[model samples]
Target: MASQWHSLVSQKIFLARNLLGQLENSNSVPAKEALLQGTIELGLRARKLVLIMIARMYQHQHSQPDSLEALGELIGTHSPEIAELNQLASDGRSWWNHLEQLERHQGNPPMARKTVSSENVIAVAADTGPDRSKQALETTLGAMKHFIDILEDRHSEW
Candidate 1:
């Protein structure tokens, strides 16, 4: 089980990296959008996998934490990188939530009319712009690299 989670973490990081590369080279708006979406999904997966890896490592040294975030706090003691990665993870998650909100608002006419004000619509539009997507991709890549480093160091200790 531990090995499987480890493999998943590596795989997700690779996928997220590949997606960001593709996003960078993409010329069409649709292609970029698709790649950005994939990158965010893989980023989230990588974050979860790293959290699980930390939890697994903690199991041997101490009792398991109640949640992934708590496990991350414990691991943060070993490396400040974990706390940095948590901030990056939070940014990536908010980016995903913004995209979801835009999609949901656009898809539901009644809900948009009843709930989405002009200011909210403008916010959603801003969230869907390429600038934030590029920033999110860069953040994801940094987080992935840091996460892999932590995992590798942990593995090497064993």
Candidate 2:
């Protein structure tokens, strides 16, 4: 499991680096366009994956508080990048997201939203999941924001 998570983290780092490269190169329009579009998708996906890892980390995470805390801080610093990527993806939805989504799904069944049929307003307890993950989410968001800054900053060489 640790190795699996390590792989994911490594891949995320690679993706982040690749995004920066693509943004800075500006040599090929089509590739740049694809990178501009893919960045958001990767950000969203990475956020989801990191949340899962963090969620697992939360279980008895007291033992490794320092590492977990560092992870949270890193994620916080990275969030803006994710948001910007999202904005870029939404700016036009171009053709990249579609193509990537299709490739990812690869004919898998589309995810469906299950409707609740509860008629009783039996006061449902407040959400546990969101509250638990809120900090981690904020941390990841911060990281994304920083990444966005790096991606958007003007490069003299470009």
The per-prediction CA RMSD against the true structure, in angstroms, equals: 6.9, 15.7
- Candidate 2 residues 43-153, lDDT tens each? 455545543444333343333222323545544535543344345446433222332343355335545644556774455564332211223323343454443234324
TM-score of each: 0.54, 0.34
Give the poorly placed runs of model 1, Cα more than 4 Å off: 1-4, 60-131
Q: Positional deviation of 92 in candidate 2, in angstroms?
A: 22
Largest lDDT belongs to which candidate? 1
Q: Give me the overall lDDT of model 1.
A: 0.59
Evaluate all candidate structures by whole-model CA lDDT and list the values in order: 0.59, 0.44
The best candidate in terms of TM-score: 1
lDDT of 1 by residue, 1-158 (tens): 45666777778877877878877678999988788767766665666556666666555344455444576577664555455544544663643344334345434444223367666565433233333456656754575656567666766577
Q: Runs in model 2 with CA error above 4 Å?
A: 59-158
